[model samples]
Target: MDRFIWSNRGIEAGETKLFSQVGVRIYDGDQKTSYDDGNINL
Candidate 1:
């Protein structure tokens, strides 16, 4: 079990962006995925 928090501040399209993400993960085999609680596509 794990927990995380992230934040990114930068310029985007001539504007400032503050993208944040929060996630939790548990591993027990037979399962795999990506955490995207915020701007993961950015």
Candidate 2:
């Protein structure tokens, strides 16, 4: 699962990208978030 939560300016500056991993965390100069999937066995 790849996701980017940024403003339009970010996209305009080529900030769009994809990420793959069993479990990972993301931060966009704000609150810290994590990617959790109990079904994944990684």
Q: Per-prediction TM-score, please?
A: 0.17, 0.26
- Prediction RMSDs, each to the true structure: 8.4, 9.8
Which segments of candidate 1 are over 4 A away from where they belong?
1-11, 24-42
User: What ranges in model 2 sit over 4 Å off?
Assistant: 1-19, 34-42
lDDT of each: 0.44, 0.41
lDDT of 2 at 26: 54
Q: 1-42, model 1: which lDDT tens digit per residue?
A: 244334464545765535634464433365654633334412
* Global Cα lDDT for candidate 2: 0.41
